[model samples]
Target: MKMDLGDQGLAGNAAAGGRPLAIEARGLIKRFDHFTAVDGVDLAVPEGAIYGILGPNGAGKTTTLRMLLGIIDPDAGLRRILGAERPHDVAHAIGYLPEERGLYPAMKAYEAIAFVGALRGLPLAEGRKRGKALLEEHGLGYAIDRQIRQLSKGMAQQVQILGTLVHEPRLVIFDEPFSGLDALNQGKLEKMIRGLAEKGTTVIFSTHVIAHAERLCDEVAIIAGGRVPFAGPVDLARDRIRPQVRLETRAEDGAWRTALPADARREGRFWNFTLPESGIEPLLRALIEGEAGILSLSIERAGLHDAFVAIAGEAAARALEEGETEERA
Candidate 1:
C-alpha cells in the first residue's frame, strides 16, 4: 500500500514533458463551502488515450469534471484542455457527456444534434446532414425524425452521444457513458467509444463501474474520497496489485503443500499463491516439472476490481488512523 511516486510525468508539465496531453489537471481541489469534494488530485491523460477514473459514488468524479469544464472553479489547481488554459476558450473543442443525461424530449433526434452543432458554430445544413448520417451509421436512423421522448432509453442515449460528437471535438469526456444501456447497447456504445478513440479523439471519463473501464481504457487512475490511490498504465497497476495466482493440478493431489511457495494456500485440490518477487518462476517450474501433475493452470492477473479493492482498503485504513488520532487529541 506504499505509494510509489515514480518518474511518470504530471499532467500539466508541458515545458519539460513536451508530449501533448489530451487532458491535464494538477493539484485539483474542489470545496463546497467547508466540505471538500475533490482533494489535491493530479491526473494526466495522454492523447488518444481512453483514460478511466474510477471510484464509488460521491467520489468527486463528477465534481472534478465540472471544474475542468469551468462549470465550477476549483478551490485551487491547474487545468488544460487540448493545450488551452481556460475551458471556455476550448469548450467548442471538448465534447462532454455528463453522468446525469439531459436532452430535449420534445425535439427530434436530428433537431437536437443540429441545435448543439449550431451552438458550436457548425453550419445548420451540415449539422442536419451529419446528424442524420450519424443516426444511420449507429443504426438509429429510424429514430432520427422521432421525438426524443418517443425513443427508448437506449435510443435516447445514442442521440446524446451523436450530439456530443457533432462538433467533432478534439477531446471527449464521458462520465458514466455506459450506465443505462442493455448488454447489446452497451456493446454498441463500447464500440462507438473505441471508434472515437481510433479516430484520434482523446477520451477521459469517470465510472463507478469497473468492467467497462477495464475493457475500454489503456490506462486508469483510481481515486477515492477525492484523492488518487494509484495512477499508471494498466500493466503497471497490475504489477503493483497484490500478486495472486490460481493453479489447478491433475489427479486432485494435495502434494502442492510440500513444494508450494511460502504464501500458498489449498482450496479443495487447487493451490493458490500470492507470489512475492523472488520465488514465482522457480516455484512455478517446480510445481510443473515435478510430480505435481499440472492439469489447468490459470494465472489470474489482479484486475481493476482487485486494484480498487486494494485502493479502497488502504483509504479506509488511512481514514481510520486519522480519526483515531483526532479522538486521542
Candidate 2:
C-alpha cells in the first residue's frame, strides 16, 4: 500500500502532550582545547513549539546542538531530550539536518533517503516507500530515481529534507537549513517547517538570519559570543525595545518644533524618533495643542532585528546584516 506522505495523522499519533518541555539544558558549557565555545547556556524548549537558536557565525549554535544530540559531551551542565537525561538512548526519536550537506553522488535519490531512515532503524523497504511519497509531496516525484549528482542544488536539498522526515521523528532539528536556497525555495522551506509544527512535531532550527525566526518561531534564543544573552517568546524580545514613530506635519513653525522631543530628527516634512516612555498620547496632544497639522503618523513596532541589536549589541547585528547583504549580492 502506498503511504500518504501528506498525512497529518503522523503528528496525531506521535504528538507529545502535557510534557511541556521537549528539550531542556542547564548551565551547558563546552570548550575546545583552550577556547571556550559554549559557556553557561540554559535552554528550555516547549513541547511542540517551533523554537529557533538565532546568532551569527561562530556563535556556538552548532556546538550547542552537538551537545544536545550527545554527539559531543559538554564540559559542564545537564540536558534532557524527550524527557531522557541521556540523548543517546532516545536518539532514534529525533531527526537532524546538519549544517553540512552530504550525499553520495552516485546514489539514487530514493535510495539515499531510504539510507537515512535505515540509520534510524527503519526497514529499508518501508523507508523507500515513504521516501517516494515524501518526494512526490514536496514536488520532487520526478527526481525519485534520479542520481544525486544529476539533480539541481534545490532539488538535492529537498531530497535530503525528505530523508530527515521519512522516519517521522517527533523532534526535528535543522541547522542553517536555509543557507543555500534562493528566496522562493526559502519560502517553500518555511511553509514546510510550519506544516511540521501544525502536525505537533517540535521543530528547532538555528540560523543567523533573523527574518526566518521572526516569521516562524514561537520562541527564540539569541546567542552571542558563545553565550545566550536572551531567550524567550519572540514578543518579549521585541518588547525590550521601544517602538519608532514617524510623523509628517504640514506646519513647520517653532510650535511644531517645540512639540517634538529633543531627540527627534527632521528629514523633509517627517519627524522620526523613538517613542518615549511617556508614550504616544503625550506627543500627539502636544503636537495638536501646538497647532502642528499632522499630515500622517505611523508607529513601527520593533522587529526581531531591532531586538537583536538592542540585546546582542551592534557588532553582532552588523554581522547579521552583512551576511544578508552578501547573500543578496
Best by lDDT: 2
Give the per-residue lDDT of model 1 (tens digit) for 137-246: 88888888999999888788878888888989889888878777777888998898899899998888887667777898888888778888777677777776767777
The global C-alpha lDDT for each of the candidates, from Candidate 1 onward, is 0.78, 0.87
lDDT of 1 at 298: 67
lDDT of 1: 0.78
Candidate 1 wrong stretches, greater than 4 Å: 1-19, 248-258, 284-290, 314-329
* Candidate 2 structure quality by residue, lDDT tens digits, 1-329: 12122332113212233447888877788888999999988888888899999998888999999999999988877777887878988888899998898888898999999998888888999999999888888888899899999998877888888888889999999999998888988999999999999999999999989999999999999998899999989999999988889999888785657757778998887889988889899888888888888899999989999999999999999888887777667
Q: Which residue pairs collide, candidate 2? A: none
Model 1 TM: 0.85
Question: Which ten-residue region of model 2 has the weakest summed lDDT?
Answer: 1-10
For model 2, how big is the CA root-mean-square deviation? 7.9
**Clashes in model 1: which pairs?**
none
